[model samples]
Target: MWRLRDKYAIAGVGYTAFSARSSVTVRDLALEACGGAMADAGLMPADIDGVVSFHFNDSVPAMAVATGLGLPGARYAIDYQAGGNAANLIVQTAAMAIEAGLATNILCYRAMNGRSGFRLGGGRELAAHGVTQYTAPYGWISYPQAMAMWCRRHMIEYGTTSEQLGAVAVTCRRNAALNDRAMQRQPITLDDHQASRMIVEPFHLLDICLETDGACAVLVTSAERARDLARTPVYIMGAAYGGGPNQGDDLFDAMRWPDHSHNYARYIADDLWASAGIGPDDVDVAEIYDCFTYSVIMQLEGLGFCAPGEGGAFVQAGRIDRDGALPVNTHGGLLSEAYIHGLNHVVEAVEQLRGQAGARQVDGAEIALTTAGAMTCGGAMVLRN
Candidate 1:
């Protein structure tokens, strides 16, 4: 173990209002988030020397954000590819840059008008040539369709039920109801989830995440430097990256990965716990990536909160609520809150650990776990106040 614990800290966090539509350009949204993060850190635009973001060339890149903010130049600028998995990668990469003495302050942000501008699921351009060539012609061009197949297989292998998955949505909505920043503040019941229209088999409208316009940013710096900043430094106690066993060279073979109903997080759970010097029992709260209801249930199992086939039972027991054993997605997550590509999960973790989450705060939140993505390239972090 390299012992990266406490080497880096998140000094500031900020975001724009979550909404269904926004007239502003993506670049403007990026700048708005960057400016808020910088202000929260008690620094001027010129003080930042690094920028990081991720998208399919839809959001503003790092260099553009640097120039737009009038930062003379950035020592480290990166615009990673893909979505969900790229969330923790951006911050972890920035932490590496700081460790290398390459930059003093790194700004990590994600901005987009997912609903009004362009919907991520309506395109097939990102698929492998194998998928576009074969599956695209058969109506397998969207994420919901592909993920539905996977979720259905999990249900078959583990005996998971849609009602069990609905529990995840209900819990997230309840949490969102308490979060003023969450887009879906209205409470939802299991009945509501089961009654919602089905987007795909095994997934209802409530099971899927919201498509909204918003931006989120977080500032990362050396733990030593962060000790002197505006807010309580949420130390990066551990960070781990892992991907699926194998993303098949083609979609045909890739479709076989879910036969076992396992996610890439299973590959990294031990490493994350060891790096953080704590086991799952020590986690005060969690901010899981809830792009889909089943994703949350499966992730809970993959992250070691419960046995492989017990995720449905675990969640059905009300352990994911605010007063439950884990209290996951305390800020509503992507399911009820606007999906900012897991960046909001990071913000919520920082807030919980700092005791600033207000009404949704987890009691005695000394340590928090935050995850990004699920199926493909994904990562997780352990944070401590």
Candidate 2:
């Protein structure tokens, strides 16, 4: 097992109150959340010496560290990735930085005003990519539509139903109702979900995630120092990531994948379990990304939560509710929570492990896991108090 697994803990997790406007620019937004996280951990900006950020992050950490919250030049700065998978990558990078003794304190974050700033319509750059140029122009317009094609294909092959899909949306919406920070606090029933208009053949608008402008940051410190901090310290037991294999975008590979050409979560899940020596059954809650409702269902199978075909039945049985055996996306998730591009899910998972999730707290949640998408990108982490 990697020593970093138990060497570092997430001493602090922070986010600006998620909003469409945030009443602040992207840089100020990051500073607010990063400040909150530092205060929560009983530290000041000067305490940090290493930073990890996305290549496209509007609110650069080292810049923030210098301007408002000053830190001397960082010992290490990583622009390793910029995708939904950023949350996990940040944690992993922080652990490595700490393990190498490059810095005693590591900060990782993401901030965006993309929502109040820009509509979720096709970017000029994306128009040239396959999600639009090839697949979308051929009628796969939105992500929900693209995902619905995959979900419908699964249903055709495995007999999944609309109710099963609706259950995923309902559970996430209900989870939102339990969370004050959730943007969409309103709850929905099976009938409400079913009655919702279809954006895609099998997906309703309710199945899609909200676009919001905000920022989230996490503080990583030595596990021992974390234990001495102000609040619960959720230990990063393990973290790992993977993307499905690809050569060219061949028809045979497409046939094998149909969804995305690979099983990212399955690979990452195996990585986490092997490194942490813990299996899926040991996890108490899941904060897997919900960019689309069906993504959660697909992750259930890929992450070993249930058998491939049993995913629909698994969710439909209320097994993912707060009281259920394995509650998931308990902080409303990206679907209902403001999607600061999926960073909030990481914060929520840490909160769940720390027993600070307030109204949405899972009982005795000692272990939690989460994932984010990067093309077919996926990653998992095991956290425990």
TM-score of 2: 0.91
Off by over 4 Å in 1: 125-128, 249-253, 256-260
Give Cα-based local distance difference scores for all models.
0.87, 0.76
Q: Encode model 2's per-residue lDDT on 298-340: one tens digit a residue.
A: 7888878888878889999999999998898998888888886
TM-score of each: 0.96, 0.91
The list of candidate 2 runs beyond 4 A from truth reads 1-3, 55-62, 125-133, 136-141, 247-262
The model with the greatest TM-score is: 1
Question: Can you write out model 1's per-residue Cα lDDT over 1-385, one digit (the tens) per residue?
Answer: 4268998999999899889888899888889988998899898877899999999767778888999999987999989876887788799889988889899999999999988887887766645475466677677777777678778878989899999999999999999998999999898889999999988897888888988788999999999889998989999998888756666553223554644487777877888899998889999999998889888877888889999989999999999889998999999999998899899999999999999999998989999999997675578999999
lDDT, candidate 1, residue 244?
64
Q: Which candidate is the best by lDDT?
A: 1
